[model samples]
Target: MVDLNAALRPADAGSLQPTAARPPARLQIADVSLQYGGKTPTLAIDNVSLEVANNEFCVIVGPSGCGKSSLLYLVAGLTDVTSGTIRVDGRPVHEPGSDRGMVFQGYTLFPWLTVRSNVEFGPRRKGLPKAEYRAIADHFLEEVGLTAFADSYPAALSGGMKQRVAIARALANDPSALLMDEPFGALDSQTRTVMQKLLLRVWEHTQKTVLFVTHDIDEAILLGDRVVVMTARPGKIKAEVPVPFARPRSISLVLEPEFIALKKRILGLLHDEIDETH
Candidate 1:
């Protein structure tokens, strides 16, 4: 069977391998509810409570408009919750800040900035000492394997490289949590696959808590420690299935009996919703 519990985790310096630490309580969504400008507020998300253990890679997947991204914006505090609470390390999330870094689908890197400059943007905003922030930027750029392109402008790199720069920028600040909103949704299959491997390696090294939102089931099953499925707008948790797969996962594994089993299981769970959406 696909081993779900073998997700990439933080590693120690002595060996470039995942080293377990006290589980980080990276993000908590406790009975949160929200909606847009509708007078009734439409209840876009209803009482969603989720716990992402420290450094865990949790993926939220569902059909389009299922409030997956809404849940992310709430956790990142880009929008306020109507009723419940969102806590990161026991503190309420009221507004956006550097503690949580966000990577959007579009490669939002400044076209005019060099790779180093883009990664350095956040720490520079924090007004740290020049040398310190520069070092931080250099480190993350290298971590994401973009060191050779440190001086290249966003316009010069391929789509995959641009995303790597974006990821480096987010990690430069060393945020405890990373929120990705369909970050790989636009890439061609080959580039997307390459980027996926790059991300797992980065996570293996950094161990940052990740809350990923995607509509792709294969991507979710391949990358997440646990997959949380949601229903359509006025979204509610439809299923919360822990991914039972092994790490260093690959496309080849998807054809395996265990991987096929989990895929069927999740698809079966979503069959009703998919049909209803038609």
Candidate 2:
């Protein structure tokens, strides 16, 4: 098992530590819905309610057009809900606040910025002192094992490395919740496996509330403490499956009997959705 804290430096003075005893943040999405309007308005997401426990890694999975990502957007405060509310740590989310950090499938890094500078952008933008943001950037880059590439630009990195930078950049902000939308979907199988382990290690170390959206059943089952499967368009919760595997999960767990059984069950549920779509 990888020990994430082993290689990292201590948090800067007055910064939150990975093992700090702060109250873990909880995310609640209640009766949420989203509709895009014009001549013919379309309801993208139906009445959906879900609660993610403090520091829990919750993964959402479904077929394409199921509005899994839309639900994520609502939580990130990047889109307005047609109706309903989203709360973070009991406070209603009205706008995109630093409390929520998002990592999209595309590496949204600034092409011209070095990896270190890109990670520091959030803190600097918030008017943090140079020393504080520099420390923040260094801590996260080290945690992601990208310290050596601090001066490297995005265009010079591989897909996996770019995503690593993206993850580092998100964490540099020290958000209570981390929202990821198919963050590893674009990687090849080999690289994706490595990234998964790295992500689990990061999640274990940071203890941030995670809401990850993915289409792969295996990936969802492997990462989430609970996996919520959605129905077809105008997405509503179809089923919520709890992952029974132990923590510090490895890719090899996918070969185990328990993992195989859970995968089949989720696949069965998804197949029904696909049938209805046709």
- Per-model root-mean-square deviation over C-alphas: 6.4, 8.7
The TM-score values for the models, in the order shown, are 0.88, 0.90
Error of 1 at 199 (Å): 0.6
Model 1: per-residue Cα lDDT over 1-278, one tens digit each = 33533322211211212226436456778778886775664778877777788888988887777788988998888899988899988889999988899999998989988999999999999999999999999899888888899998999998889899989999888888999999999999998988888898888889889999998788888888878878776677776666767576675766777666677767776677778888
Best-fitting candidate, scored by TM-score? 2
lDDT of 2 by residue, 1-278 (tens): 32323212212221212234323448878788899999999998888887777888989988899899989998999999999989998899888988899999998999999999999999999999999999999999988889999999999999999999999989988888999999999999999999999999999999889999999889998998777888899898887766767788888999887778778888888899999989
Per-prediction tally of clashes: 9, 0
- Clashing residue pairs in candidate 1 are 2-244, 2-245, 3-244, 3-245, 3-246, 4-243, 4-244, 4-245, 24-54
Write down the worst ten-residue block by lDDT for model 1.
8-17
List per-prediction Cα lDDT, in the order shown.
0.81, 0.86
